[model samples]
Target: MSKLIFVNLPVADLPRSIAFYEGVGATKNPQFSDDTAACMVVSETIHVMLLTHAKYRQFTAKAIADARTTSEVLICVSEDSRESVDARVSAAVSAGGTADPTPTQDFGFMYGRSYEDPDGHIWEVMWMDMAAANEAMACEGAGQAA
Candidate 1:
């Protein structure tokens, strides 16, 4: 069986978070959702659990960090191409997210951009060509060793 990843995020507004995630291409899975939480499926193996602030407190005693003011985590996902990465960021912005909370990264082989959700959680979208990246790294290594 393939291992799946479920990224649990505390959201101030469950419905709004659901809409934002959906806007960025995640599908809501009603079977695992309720008024206090939502299951947003990003892919066959990636799932995002959006929990209301109150509902999230049930899992931990620590106070939830105000995502807008403090950085706790930066989540990243890969797209198939550079265009897709840009499209995802654009969608996020359209859905109330703030685009480019961080600087854009464009190494010839890899392209990436980030957006902050309404709750201020950052999600980075990136695309890379592994073959090209490996070739570049190998050449750099050889040059350094010379």
Candidate 2:
């Protein structure tokens, strides 16, 4: 079976979070959703579980960090091209997310941007040309050896 990833996030407002995720291209999986939690599907192998603060507390004993004010986790996903990366960040901004919580990254072979969800969880979107990245890294390695 292909490995799947389920990212669980604590959200202050369930419905708002659901709408925000849907705006960013995720679809809610009703089969796994309820009043307190939502299952948002990003891809066949990637799912995000949006839980209310109460629902989230059931799973963790640590205090929930205010993502807006404190750094917790940086979730990253890859896109097909540099344009797609920018498009996703724009969509996120349109959906009420704050864009570029972190600085944008652009190398010849790679590009990246980030957005912060309503709850301040940062999500980074990136695209890369593997061949170019490998070639650059190889050159850097050779220079180091020399």
Candidate with maximal TM-score: 2
- Per-candidate count of clashing residue pairs (backbone under 3 Å): 0, 0
Roughly what TM-score does model 2 have, to 2 decimal places? Answer: 0.99
Q: After superposition, how far is residue 66 of candidate 1 from its true place, in Å?
A: 0.8
- Per-residue alpha-carbon lDDT of model 2 for 71-113, expressed as tens digits? 9999999999999999999999999999999999999899999
lDDT for each of the candidates? 0.95, 0.97
Per-residue C-alpha lDDT of model 1 across residues 1-146, encoded as one tens digit per residue: 99999999999889899999999899999999999999999999999999999999999999999999999999999999999999999999999999999999999899999999989999999999999999999999999999
The lDDT of model 1 is 0.95
Clashing pairs in 1: none
For residue 74, model 1's alpha carbon misses the true position, in angstroms, by 0.7
